[model samples]
Target: MKITSLCILAIGLAGSARLLPSQPQDEQAKSSATVEGVFVDQDGAPLEGVHVLNRIWPGAESSTESDGDGHFEILLEWDGNKDGTWYEGYARKEGRAMLKFRADLRAGQEFDFGRLTLTPGGVLSGEVLDASGAPLSGAMLLVVDAAQQASAPEGAQADGPPWEQVIDRGSTDASGAYEIIGVPPGTWFIVAKHESTWWLWSEPIRLEAGKRATASPFHLESLPAEYQIQGRVVDPGDKPVANAQVATSVLSPDGRFMMQTTARTDESGQFVLFFSRLPSGTVDLRVQPEGDELDDGSLLDVSPGARDLVVHLGGTKVLRLHVVDDTGRPVERYGWGLSIDKPGSFVMTGSAPAFHEGGYATLRVPEHPFELEIRSDAHDRKEIGAFTPDALPKVLEITLTSSQAISGYVTFQGRPVPDVFVELVQRTPNYLDGVVEGHWNGLYYGLESSTTHTDQSGRFRIPNDFPHITYYARAWADGYAEGTSGPVKVGATGVHVELGVGGEIAGVVSVPRGLPPGGIELEFYREEIKASSINTSVGKILRTITDDDGSYSQPHLDPGTWLVRVHPSGTLLSDLGWSEAKVEAESHPYVVTVQDQDTTYFDIALGRDEPCILEGRISVGDKIREGYSELLLEGPFALDLDFSGVDEHGRFRLVARSSGKYRLVINAGPGHHQYKTITDLVELVPGTNAWERDLPVDQWTGEGIRLDAH
Candidate 1:
């Protein structure tokens, strides 16, 4: 009867299944399944040598290739159990979007998809030329889709997509012609980047299936000549400071310091600083020599031409500090920082002191009134302030108290949840609060100290060496909702936390006709209140992709009001591109109220595309800057959409996509002074959107933006 059941299971699995001969009944039972399929192109022609991947079945050869006749087979081995098992298959060729399929399988099941179709790929070709109309050789060309563009990291090469996101890439030949073959059918952005010139991009281009798209010739703009700052570094005795570090800073038009290039002095104590994108006008330049007592920084004018200069570090003040524990023993491995006392000055200079002997370290700074702070890994931080170096002791003594340990256990539904990760976050003053004073202080709390995991018994212990700080504990585990503990002082006794059973939200994302050709992602956001105020912060964003059938489920979501929406892959309009207003009108989000240990089902039907409008004002300081702001909208895949300038009323309007996050960069130049501000993660809704915001003056200080500077 068992042998008959195995044969029946194999035959019932699928019509295309192939059952192998039965194994010896005396031996341990061995069961296997076979899946057979054929690959063909859209026009019904067999696709030879296509690669088919089997991702659904584990413990098997992952891939196989179609034969000349486009026929392929996959063998899957299964354990004795046959309940609730499934398999997935994917087929692909170079330069094509993968074709996906899925099916259910049992221990002795054999399934055949019969024949699968593959979509054809496209091609992009173009030529690159210099500004003078001469063919530019050795230039790189990149093709990218919308998803790759939107998720690219900041400061990534603007000339082309990042290496990992490049769908197709090619280098210009002697004739400046480049061809990228096997580009999948989609809307793509093409860019040409030269080694010595600025990048040139094409407007969005659509490539149709099995067709070649010829793009317009790209003209590369010449880059400005390299600005050089050549100078020599010397000590107070006018002796060459060989191998000394030379640093420079450029001042912005708003009178803020911006750190620039750095170079180490050669044997001759001479260094040359090069700037590929040097700003114009006078720049504040500072030079510091390695292990020297001198401060040599000044203002210098920069231009396209190279110039010679010299810097001399005069006498500087050296302050020594000694760190020790409560036992009066020298403590090694400590960090210290210094802050100067001046209006609009929020620079905090830090150093990793090498406690070679007696826990003593030295620091060189300008002669001024300064506040000092010191901290260690295993101790509480210490701070001392308002002391002038002229009246200081030779070695300042600083003490640190030993850290404490906190132990705890995690439970869900009265049962221990092992392998739970607990995070200890320190709570500090909300710097954004209006009541907070000081430029850089009082905005946020210090960094989190340590993380520990619970054992099989749900027990966890923070190391005894953790710093003493007021913190709260948050615990989370796979397939479970997160839980938070109240603020606990590290010096207190053991803590306990209880997590609620996680719930699941399952749904299907479908387009008007059917599922999108490619994969789609669903974004889940939970609204949380900031501090103890009513201001809301978008918290705990969870993202998951849909399967081939456009079905998705996210389990272990904490009990709360969650806003769930579909984000279509690529530059599709109905997905992330919808505006908030349009989404509300169209009921785009599937708002679900989750309960502990329960499941909720919701289905979403994407809406039609609608025109989007964005209008906003640019304010500089307290006054609106009319007709001065230049805004650039950067969309998914780094598509640069240049818009018109601001009107005389300091207001600007733009037509954009319905949904998706954008980066807005406002550049304005009052006289020869240029100021720029960037606001990232700007969400756009359908219909009309209005914004009135201030454009803070861009700061260029080497330390960071001055907290007091506007």
Candidate 2:
């Protein structure tokens, strides 16, 4: 049996956009690309009712539930390739205590992930007590990893992180007892904190899969007075706005330091909110004055001054949003966003978004004019509303087109070059890539990217939601040089790229006996410019890793004198029994040629057999750097498997079979940070290495294990 369902939301930067009139639904059902996968429980039995969600950039989401047999298939947004899309998402059960199983999707291809297993988690119950042994009521209980909660503020180095994960949490009742189900099986410590008492932790408890563990009582002490935010909400005329919804929020660009709490004002329009401690940065106090029957209220942005705040609110305008196709028919599912001076979501605590399903919504938006961005999986995006405050409309209707696509081909000397990976990028300001780049923190910028593999005919199509903007298409294939189509502007029927057969290189890598294949990295570099007859290193151009048989190959090279370097190269030594290691051992740079239509062969025997030890003493803390966890040597080579622990005197050692210049990353408390890294590269020869100075924990910042196997 087969089943399918879709949910999509379209949101991007606040800008201007337009929609084409609606067409018949059947006319919009052209692309037939599909992807499928399966889900099972820890017992290997098919798990049903799993929600599989898929999303593309510019806010397009599609979702479906698993059938009885655990199989699910979803229709992809097919433009044939005119606009290739980067797809990502995960599959999760509704209420099971299982961790979310992420789906590994190729940039633009469709495939199955065989069988994904979801493990049902265990449960945890606990009690809270005061220093005097009396039960404490209304204490918030949190379950987290024990490392960060250890008796001392010492640090440890872990392959991944010191995991301050909030696995599960619950609040204590009249008896000070709390039970939280769905706590994933793991070693956890319980933390109890009440408004009137200090935060305290219980001893670490390692839980069994699908079982239960009761935590010991936590004895907390009396807490001092916390920072209280004083505020009031009033109408423009100075009249008190009674029972106004108020909230104090602190958001930091870095994930550190965040808190949010909601409350309502009394008859005097006065409200008080408290935080465990005074936050360091900016704090936003939002107030929504209660509106009468016809209005739904709006939020007032305020900043606290001297712990006291006053805000004036005149309510807001009602915006009725309707999204339709070319034929004026409602789109099935869509998401919209609003932004004015900056990008932000208008979502608040109590509003329900059920109305988003029918391409319709009634929103109580800020009175200030703002841009409304809407989208659906099949439709093109455009900013629809950016009205002047006085001209803001009560009802806004938008029309969109779903038949948008961009098609093209890659050819080598007039012959089609199949199997090429085509990449499309738009450079216009406020475009798809522009919007995603700002919010994603430099993860993907300026390049709103779409990717797809060329078909047998060398033809490709990418669904173009922003066809009105200019784009550039680049392609690279096995037998042809990389090609680019510059300035594929709006209304361009196709993007044509011409490739040439440049130089090609192939080689086999020989490593130590037990070294598995595919972890080695190779970087290609070219001289800054051919100013002189000889080539001199400037910047890197390309990089590739070895295949299963320790072989690597690449074609489509630009004709130039190339120098291949193994600077900072390593291989991942993965599990023979669930452990992994990153072995850094590579050869020096080898000069190669990229002459037209030529092929070069080079063989490499990596790292010497002799062992090299780089040992050092290290400690961590905000103040006294004592206690040792584990630290990371990111460059050259890493020995995550061996003992790199520090002793009571803060001494440690790291031994690797191979050696090179390495970087030191002080990994502690959840994870390491930019500040924890040592900029100076420590070169290790065939013997012992040292820092010569006392190693310090400059900065410490702070996913996954699958236990489905029975």
Candidate 3:
């Protein structure tokens, strides 16, 4: 992932390579039988009543019923689905009865059949405590599975192991004690969150079948200490003053300051303020009195306590301005604005020119360095660098110039484009890679605006009034293609140009044609230039699910080399929380090229993965705890799969791409503490899921505080 210091920073993840090894043909020749058993949760010690089926049986279909012993009988049937010559593998039948299933099942007739014994699933329990050690009511705990990491949402993404599962949910109890039951037996990751900002994440834990896990006490810290500022407001003669409003603010290291408290001075000329929370760094103090003008200022180190200080008043600084035309001749009465640069921040002052017979007016500050910016209606602007203290007291000077404009017409597919927002994107070098950055509202050194919504005839004008020494522009319209132009020098007038829209691409996405038709999702990617080369993913072109018709499209594209791919929305499902039916593209690779005048059409096929089903439970001491719990997983030693689970009888099953080593973690819902590192590395082979784990039992058992199940 790459990180940069922008207004809003974002990063992308690197793709993982496919690594499950292939099975031998000789292994497929052996006769196999089905081994069936009962799923008894350790906490409840009861049988799971729901029928678990392997539909499209590449694997044999089996049924089980619990006897008086709490163990069930396994009955088997022969292969229900056959693989044709062109097919590579079969679907593994597994999923909740109501939700969707996307995995294929492998043939089960090759393995040896025997009396399969199923053990009770595991449990995770713990207490949520505040800074004072008292239970904190209303906290939340979350669990994430480790194997399906690629597809989970934002907060849950970091909790899962490298690539197993990703899910988030949890809530706390009235006493802050939480028990996450019904977790699968495996490695899981857990987290506890309070008040949205304060949180705690546990190291990965593993729970084996029939065992319960207890977590070390998890405590939420108190809010950070606050600081108090008090000062007096007085005139230049040092006399006591009354009713002067004073304000406090702290600068953030990344270039911003949040206002704290604003209060007025009392009859004693003194004002007292208590900041809610002091920011963790250097701070600046600002004081402004209401009514008749009196200037006062002070700077101090503000820590976590009441601070007393004194501020003195003085004459304000006078500012002078002049508006000039492109010819350098003075112009009268123009719209204008002013701004200032303070440490870690900036503020826009009064708009409209400060006018007087002498072209001057007075302003005041705490006697420090500041940058002054002045702008006018004619599109001209001027900036004066750092102004420290002037030895001789005087007024500041500002001069601006008039600007020129560019006019032109635009059309898409030979028709005038109207009611569309036309953006004038200027190309600028990105320090990290050299390629032009993405378009944004126009600014001089940054993106600056020109004009928008051309008139009925598709003719418009862009006034060259911003600070850029030079500019290049691009025009864009939603649902229609965008066009770009070569660089145009700033300050030049009467430049003319025309824009044209390109053709579109569309096609159907489906699974390999020979198999029984099933649902799948498809996504599109558009290759773009970045850095000095084109080796990275610049942006996503089009993202749409295949309809029952399996059709998709690249609504717009610049004629160029194109690469298309289809995959089960495994990645997108985990990333964006998208539902299955909406994504129709295949989960395989495809390619196509679009020419300037060609409306390209094509088709793509996809491949699917086998499924593995897991079952487990959560417990505290000797009792069953009810509530939501999540499952988190990690690989051989790496964080990967991150998934979640909710408990009634404490059981859960999840899907995966391919299997390898995995870890498991479990957590309780909101206002609760969580248990972690309860399970260790377990192997997941295709067509088999005899996997079992127990979350360590948390011992909260005592005389009248027992947890009761309804």
Best by lDDT: 1
The estimated TM-scores of all candidates read 0.38, 0.38, 0.37
Top model by TM-score, which number? 2
Question: Compared with the true structure, what per-residue lDDT tens digits does model 1 show for residues 586-685?
Answer: 4334456666678888776676556456777755553334333322233212223335476545577655534655545444433334433323335678
Residue 487 lDDT in model 2?
Answer: 77
Ordered list by lDDT, greatest first: 1, 2, 3
Instruction: List per-prediction Cα lDDT, in the order shown.
Output: 0.58, 0.53, 0.44
Clashes of each: 18, 23, 108
Per-residue alpha-carbon lDDT of model 3 for 1-710, expressed as tens digits? Answer: 00000011111221111111111101222322333333333243434342333332332333333454344333344322221111111111111111112232123321111122233445566777876788876566666664433332333221223222333234557777765544456766666655422456565667565566666666766443344566687777887678865665644333444444555689878976644345676555556555324544445564445455676654334334444555555544333333444444454444343223333333443233555555543345667666654642444445654446555566776667664444444433322121112311121121324544565776655556454655654565666555655467655443333444456577765544343222343444433222223221212234455565566666666554344555443222322323453232122224455667568887654444444334555444433333332222331112123354646444555433346544333433223343221232345655556544332454332221111110
Query: Model 2: runs farther than 4 Å from truth?
Result: 1-125, 128-190, 194-198, 201-215, 218-247, 250-274, 278-283, 287-367, 370-500, 514-548, 561-582, 587-593, 608-710
RMSD of each: 20.5, 15.8, 24.7
Off by over 4 Å in 1: 1-230, 234-268, 271-285, 288-348, 351-379, 382-409, 412-473, 487-492, 515-518, 528-539, 571-588, 608-710
lDDT of 2 by residue, 593-653 (tens): 5677887887766554444566664444432233333322342122122334444444556
Worst 10 residues of 2 by lDDT: 701-710
